[model samples]
Target: MPDERTHARAQIRGVKETAEADLLAKKNVIGVDIADKVTDGKNTGQLSIVVFVEDKQPTSKLSAADRVPKEIDGVPTDVQQMTVELQGPSMQLVDDVTPQVDTTTYAVLHGGISMGPLRSVYLTPPDVTSAGYYIFAGTLGAMVRDRGNGATMALTNFHVACVNSTWSVGDRMVQPSLLDGGSSSNQFGSLTRATLSDDVDGSVVTVDTGRSTTPSVQDIGDVAGHTAATVGAAVRKRGRTTELTYGTVISTDFTVTINYGSDVGSRTLHHQIRVQTDTSRSARFSDHGDSGSVVMDNNRMVVGLLFAGSSDGQWTFANPIQSVLDELNVDLMVAPVVTRPIVSCLNTRLVVCNITRPVACLFTRSAGCNLTRTASCLVTRAVACNVTRATWCPVVTRTAVTCSVFTRAGCDIPIPDPGPIEGGQSEDGHGYGATADVPEEYWAGYLAALEEINELDGPDEA
Candidate 1:
């Protein structure tokens, strides 16, 4: 069912070899390729010989016959200039000025693997007071593994994590971010390697084995793995700034010029994937602080790493996740489930209920509870949890009171409980005291009774 124009293009594609040789024979013609004929920014479905030239109008003393071709093999030709240049990290260009310190709570370890935004960290060359630390804000990106030895590493933009080539390998990387008062106590990893290629802007930080870490991301859950990106693929992401969002890949093998803000000059990047936001779906592809977030496909496969974008949110760019992994010589760290002690409880009917492993409870009420995944039982209460993927495992709640639970980064549920109240007046004007004398052995039965009453009142009654 090919149209006339499509047939013509197919014909042109077959005979383009002869056209390319003839075009290259002409002066100033550097390269040639078969291309679609575009008019008014739309492809007409017709093919042409795209001729590359040094100059459209050469001022040198050359004969008229030596000029670039206007047509080849009776097909139209386009004379275009394509000069590519590569630049290193932006901090290298703007190191003369004092960097502004951004003290914000990005990410820091509270339990095991904690994910968050990255505020600027201060680093200086040895014995140089005049030197300034690289300062900027971006997401932590994701966790990856060393290809050679299977060691885990942290991933992010070369500019964001390495301060645009300002820091050296073995330099300290902290969390809660220095802007948020990070110090030696907050050190999470160290710079191990990095790459700034025509196709990528990335760095790898070797995770400190002494610290607790997880490969899971916030809201989006664990990254199953990575794959090559293709046009029209549905994609999603989670970052410190933008918790979770999704869009579709509109273009691939894209080349673009990106601005690095005020002090840093612009640079060109090639072979990028372009994602367009669907405002109707309230989609957001990227933002200023979202750089380094891993972009995943609808299948939960990692596709790209978000780096740059238009300020208006119309378009965004990402290096192929496969390319990033290859460039860094590492593989993605599969998300791991949290391990906790086994805990159980009794429902309102006095029947012992065995809470499953890897379950998270966002909230608990008298009548029901919000679990990370749906659990079915013949009890009188309802248990609800958001299920995104099937890999969710059991973990303990951040606030472990009685037998309640909470989801981890690899699970699809929100943290549901508030901190335990100490000696204070209850909302109902009942005063609670630590010194209140109650029979110790009766505590378990009393708590079960209290929970029954709470469930009967439901979550809203709180």
Candidate 2:
């Protein structure tokens, strides 16, 4: 059964489909879509068909035919004023000013870094032909694997990678971008696929051999996978100019018209995800040069491919990640998830054991090493413990077992006095002292084991 949000979204989509053409034809209207209803600049927790306009005006100043209705097919209509444009640098005349350079270089290419066509066309703007040219670049959104050949590729917006309609396959792609001081020597890949449609504005570049690429996003870690964008969900992006920023999914299944300059002209995109800056974490979600950044949820799952935004940077738009992936026929190149084995012990005094080698247990006296039988043990010690696999020890009583003169057959090792176990006392006055002093690498496992022991064993007792 569809939940409340899903049902509401379906209803809004229906109303939008029926009313979109008519709404776009209205005066000052730039786009239309479904979004959370806003009243007096605050969201009202209600879904509505949003009418995007270049400027908001009072009904008294508008003609009756141009005025937007309050409701469409029983759904509320929200008239929002914002100027939306493709979030990429268009052809512009650069006289003598030096472009700001991003000096960071990546040996292994990944997402969330500057990239673009190997060379931006040097165009002579009409009437001014004094050595002026256009240098363009945008964020490399992600790394993907081609479905047909399993070859690695870099993902970015078509406008960022293609530059113009004259672009062809095998065109060289560069890192850091020409605008960011990247030269022809910095070429890393070549454009293999691209699409500019109502659903996506994405492209993929075949990464060159000998050049390594990871699935991780800069500053955001690895992307586990991709998921559908959910309204009101928190999302983030690491882009070329913005680096890392937070936002909220204010709307989905959005249809917006963006001007891609003269090269591509104005194209209307459908089924886009609209995001608004999460003011608590950032003032803006994206900006020029941030195009092609992948928007991911809190769990680091890709949700959208950022492509467009408002001129003021408050509102941003993205193509759903699934749409982009489908269009390119590629899958996200993600790292495998690693699961660690759990180590547990019963006695109050924690024992550091090297499971990889022969059974050799070392006991040390340190605070915070309280763990019970059946509880996972992870403790920090000065000495490193080689624990590749989990080892289970039988439940033992709380008796002081000194290791001053202890030895085991076939195991020749020196025994150090762990001193007296102290501090862990019960009401019965009979309890064992918990020892801490595990290697730093194993500290996380030990802490988890201690928590489990405390929960299962409750209070320390004789």
Candidate 3:
């Protein structure tokens, strides 16, 4: 069944690739991709090439050259009306006198939290404000590890981490972002790598020393791994602004043009994933501040890294997770699972056996001897005279007996002892032998061990 679906998807992808360029050239058209065919506002469960347009107009209103074809290369085509743009937020001033505190101010970092590069901009008279500079913020998507150096890192959008072409490696990146009231003291990491290419607009940041991170996404659970996006698959995401939202994959293999404001201009991203708010839910899938959030399927397998969305957020776009990871040369930081060895025993007639069982009993031996004497009266009578010299003889005999018995009580059961505490109590005041916060220097060692365990045993099925 899965193979058949893959083959059908591939056929649709070929048709999309062939017609994408020509479709994108049409007026009002913004993107093209493969998606489920929608008829009368209902999904038909049929694969088709989808063309996204800025506006939906009647046939008479659009020129013949601008009209989208009903079908292309024998594959059906669907025109979806929407406008797309990069999801990064614009710079804004800090207007409130009282400081605001939230997850953005979190000392420990994780995914689905606000963060951004520190940038300062001046506003003129029209935007009157006492604040001297402006700030912009976006979501911190996920935790990642560098494939080459194994350094702990965080994932986000290039526009969120870099902002402009002036960005360089080692530029400051902060938690809660400056826009979220995060200042220099909140600085957690620095930008390490970034790519704004035909397929990805992603970046990585170095997690600084003394800081710690977990693989779990806020409001969601841990990410197991990544998988390819499929049309009609239910998905969800957690972001800085939206917090948590449910959606569905409306299209895959998308190529869309996104406007990154005046600084980065417009960029064409290919092989993107398009998601729309689930019909059962009323909330938007993403917003301006949600850029860089990772999108996960129902099973918690990441499908994409969100970077763009429509103005109203009814529709959003993301770079395929595999492409993002490949471009960054990194892997997702997954949670480690605790495991214990399995013990088994076998029993035979009069014997109990176990490879790992401890010895049960100790064996010892003791011996004693007794003496006995016998006399020959008959012979003594015949040689009375001569036997006067015959004296009594003494004989001694020694005997020993051994026995063996086996019982269930004779077998020893081993009991495991808990190891000594290392960092004292956990956050909940329980002595779990581990600290709630681990030092940043130890993260590399821990991550290495986690990688080894994952390779040997794979992730926990539960």
What would you estimate as the lDDT of candidate 2?
0.76
- Locate the minimum summed-lDDT window of 10 residues in model 3: 375-384
The residue-by-residue lDDT of candidate 3 on 188-246, one tens digit each, is: 89899999999999999999987989887888999888899987799999998877899
Cα lDDT of model 2 by residue, 272-337, tens digit: 898989889998898888899999999999999999899898889999999999999999998799
User: In angstroms, how far off is 36's CA in candidate 2?
Assistant: 3.7
lDDT, candidate 1, 324-387, per-residue tens = 9889999887755568644333222332122222222235433234433322111112122222
Query: lDDT (CA) for every model shown?
Result: 0.56, 0.76, 0.72
lDDT of 1: 0.56
Lowest lDDT block of 10, candidate 1: 374-383
TM-scores, all candidates, are: 0.50, 0.74, 0.68
- Decide which is better by lDDT, 1 or 3: 3
Global lDDT of model 3: 0.72
**Regions of candidate 1 where Cα sits further than 4 Å from its true position:** 1-134, 180-184, 259-267, 336-462
- In angstroms, the error of model 1 at 51 is 14
Q: How many clashing pairs in candidate 2?
A: 14
Please tell me which model should have the higher lDDT, number 1 or number 2: 2
